[model samples]
Target: MAVEVAATRRRFTRAEYYRMAEAGILGEDDRVELIRGEIVEMSPIGRRHRAFVGNLNQLLVVRLAGRAIVWVQNPVALTDDTEPQPDLAVLRRRPVPYKEREAWAEDVLLLIEVADSSLAYDRSTKLRLYAEAGIPEYWVVDCVAETVEVHRDPGPEGYRDVSRVAGTATLALQAFPDVELTTAEIFA
Candidate 1:
């Protein structure tokens, strides 16, 4: 005769995740983000990832000045169970700083994720999450493939439109048609 045992897993809400951070249960050094009620560890930023993010930030800041706010590696609240810190978020201009409150999907014009090792996760899970949250535009910069995947027209099933660009091809946003950059400029 043998005895049987059952194992269960507990899922957390966004509020609980914040409480853990406030209580010092989660430290500032912890590279983690909440996704669908699960705390997922973020990949360490490599030199390539850092450099690309910096370059994009500089370009975006110069181009989008006064038109929108460029947020770097900051969390954007998606839902009660999901908060993802995208590499770059172009937010609608607001009078108050985001420090007063977290940026929500409604406030975003475009979201960019510079992906090297985390390309798959960014394309799949993160993509679905963003689409479900109704984020208008999402871009995944694939360092491995040296291509940029653009997603737009978010729907419940996922993004209705998806495109890829690389090399000298230029990328533009539907929200900011004036802002355009070539793939070379992005991955440079």
Candidate 2:
């Protein structure tokens, strides 16, 4: 029997990704998902997915401070090997962000991913990646299960504390306590 090793390709830089986006090949609404070193075509966004994202964005913006901007569907640059476009990113407001330039992980305060069908991938692959970057907070909105998986205390290995916020449970932001959002509102 012969053993074969899988070869992984290096992820493209923000500049390179912009080139591909500008090339008009990915399409306007193709639902393509990208993470560390990989570009993937994600499952189509259903109505539930859209609703959840919209609601979360509004809640975060309303509850959080004005200086903390709520970014919707933007690529958070982690490294040359990782750039995952999170669904909702609560970042410190910058004069120029995805509005002018790409937002990097350093700019991010909280990263969120709404997972319906991609729950496994979100918890396993994406979770580790975000932790590796030492993001303060990471939320995985598991639509199917109707739960919010909050990852905290990020280290090189990954997030140490994994809390499941269900029902009326709330997630308080590290920088903003007034930014209290309900688990139901997010899953709804």
Candidate 3:
């Protein structure tokens, strides 16, 4: 006899996810984030990834100090079903600290992902997620390629503008023209 059964997977809302965390079902050591109603395990940060994020954080903080808040490896509430902790998030300056309330998509000026082992996931899943959230700008620092991929002009369909800058080139955000970052410095 042959038997067939269809298996169903459970999808959780943001509130439910938070409840799980509060109830101690999820531990502090867990490297996970909610993505499109599913709990996705995040890759461990390698040396290159950590160094890249650290450098970017230093650069952005120095360049945008008092102008924007530089958040490193922190969660950004994208939607009720999605809260992703990007590698770095440049947020709008708020009267109250983010510790009082986490930054939502609307507060995000720029989101960056330093992609090495997670390059494919960052370029595809994370890209779509950020675009759907209407995040103004997104950057994927492709360590393997030694280039940065910039996405802008977000819409329901996705980012209308996508460009790649080589390691030797410089990148300037349209929103902040005064802040320019060289790819070499970022990838270094």
Each candidate: RMSD to true structure? 2.4, 2.5, 2.2
On TM-score, who's better, 2 or 3? 3
Please give, for residues 89-121, the per-residue lDDT of candidate 2 as tens digits: 988877775668777777888998898887888
lDDT string for model 1 (1-188, tens) is 77776865677899999999999999999989999999999998988899889989999999988899999999999999999999999999776778898899999999999998899899999999999999999999987777888999999898999998977898887788989877787778
Q: Model 1 off-target regions past 4 Å?
A: 1-8
How does each model score on lDDT?
A: 0.91, 0.80, 0.90
Q: Write the per-residue lDDT of candidate 3 for residues 56-124, one digit (tens) a residue.
A: 999999999888888898889999999999999999987888889879999999999999899999999
lDDT of 2 at 163: 85
Q: What is the lDDT of candidate 1?
A: 0.91
Model 2 root mean square deviation, Cα atoms: 2.5
Off by more than 4 A, model 2: 1-11, 95-100
Clashing pairs in 3: none
**Where is the poorest 10-residue window by lDDT in model 3?**
2-11
